[model samples]
Target: MPQLKGIKILLVDDEPNILRFLEIGLQNEGFEVLTAQDGLSAITLVKQFQPHIVILDVMMPGMDGFEICRMLKKTENLAVIMLTAKEEVEDRVKGLNLGADDYMVKPFSFDELLARIHARIRNHFPNMWGEVVAGPFRIDDRRKEISYEDKVLELSPTEYELLKFMAINNGLVLSKAMILDKVWGYDFNGEENIVEVYIRSLREKLNDREHRLIRTLRGSGYRIDVQ
Candidate 1:
């Protein structure tokens, strides 16, 4: 089987043993892994590693995993998974609503994690390049490419994924709260800074003055519509 290489992961938990085990497991699967013990540290690591995926524990001192998941979703370019102990409909709902690509209960199989990760990766960037055109911006899903007025825009992998998510769900009044839940990961609790940061970063790259395809709906999240 051809290997899936270069997937960077950030594992956040207060338990050192769990962190070590997960890191080893992910590394064994050929993924680069980073770990954090708390929410603040997780955020910093998130900024530094800019991980492709995050496995966050929902319970922690100071800032819990849910809180962290909430923050990361709002970030410019990040994806997350809830590796938590909460196993209830409400917990699942909470995590999914936060932007978690996937969620798993504790003692989950490493194989399961690997599988979910692979699936999401493939889903986000397929081989078909299913094109999504909104105004001047065109998204080629297969190659994970986006362009404005035929000018190719440089986008980070996370940025491309975020844009694609919004483009697919265009016209819906997605909340900043929900975008954080759906696009980022479920482990996030309630921070909104990450989402805003990424939006700003995306605007800078998209040159909002010219394109401004991403719109900020008052009292709502954001939207992309052709004017």
Candidate 2:
């Protein structure tokens, strides 16, 4: 099962290998990730993307991580975790003073970094932590599973993404265009009827033949009415 939370994270590092490695790891763990090799681009992406957390590397050309973190914390309501090769106490203190929520040295375990990211999310954005429960459905992002009425649903990758998106926006009327852009990438050149096909599949699996839980709004689109 793929992790389903749409948590956005920004990874800033000047090293291509480091960026590629972390990007693949985090994406596998179900995070929406964006990367920047320089501080200026990092700042720009932060304003544009508004990620929930930032993984910052301290040593870089132009503007360093410390200065970037300082600028970010002043205007952004997000967590910052600093990474550095140096193990000096002064550097750690400086990062913390500049509003970094956590610190990790280079060569750190990926598991440890994942744990710290969860910790920071829990500490800083407590409301967004853990499973998403709405009506009879429970979406466990960490486990990448969704259960209906305490029974886990066997869902394909696309089904999982589509259902999770609907569950997140449960009472809102979601048009086909919006669903396609989100579930399938905006760059997906497929036909719009693809949304209808997936919706039918989800309805069948969900036993929503009567359209009580998943409703079709004539010309508008679809909605998940759990009540």
Candidate 3:
């Protein structure tokens, strides 16, 4: 819905049928789709295609999606959505921690997947163009980067989105549900603990022990208070 045309998307899966199905489906949606059957090939295609978003499948024969997500994170501005057959929370958390922007279990609805893809694209490429400053923290929307005190913080895709969203609404108590709807999108069907997991990760990156940028509100939620 958000001008998906000409946006490059890479699909990585071991199943030939799955690859073909997703390719056709995405192509029909006006996305420029590419396919890879393994992690190694996926990496190669990513380099060549320079896709804006990658739909990666876990449990490949060789490199695996986790490793691929890590590799891709090194590239600036590439959004990754992982596909996994395992429904375990650990797997989902692992992917998010490894820098995946989102993940969908196997046998997932194509429509839901498309919605996630759109949401991720919109989050990563917001219309606003400028730097958001709150105390020592800064979010450069144009560059898609965040900095703390003058030093740039190395953040995963999900962490970056969460931080940016909070920074935009600095000092406001944002509930977990509000965060899920804003950062993860309204259609997210994953566990709410996912928010806790990412918050822990963000706090670590922000060095909150000393700076105390993100504060937890016991009964409410969390807020970014740059004091």
For all candidates, what are the clash counts?
Answer: 22, 0, 0
How far in Å is the alpha carbon of 112 misplaced in model 2? 0.7
Identify the leading candidate in terms of lDDT: 2
Error of 2 at 92 (Å): 0.2
**Model 2 error, position 227 (Å):** 30
Score residue 96 of candidate 2 by CA lDDT.
Answer: 99
Q: RMSD of model 1, in Å?
A: 15.8
lDDT of 3: 0.84
Candidate 1 local lDDT, 1-227, one digit each (tens): 11245668899889999999988887875678889898999899888888878888898999987778888889635567787777888988888898887889988876667667766656654432266555566777667798878988888886777776676555555687777777777788758877887788888987786545788878877887753
Query: Each model's TM-score, in the order given?
Result: 0.54, 0.60, 0.56
Q: Give residue 99's lDDT in candidate 3 (0 to 100).
A: 96
lDDT of 2 at 36: 100
Best by TM-score: 2
**Ten-residue segment with the worst summed lDDT in candidate 3?**
125-134
Off by over 4 Å in 2: 1-4, 130-149, 152-227
How big is the positional error of residue 32 in model 2, measured in Å on the Cα after superposition?
A: 0.1
| lDDT (C-alpha, whole model) for all candidates | 0.76, 0.89, 0.84
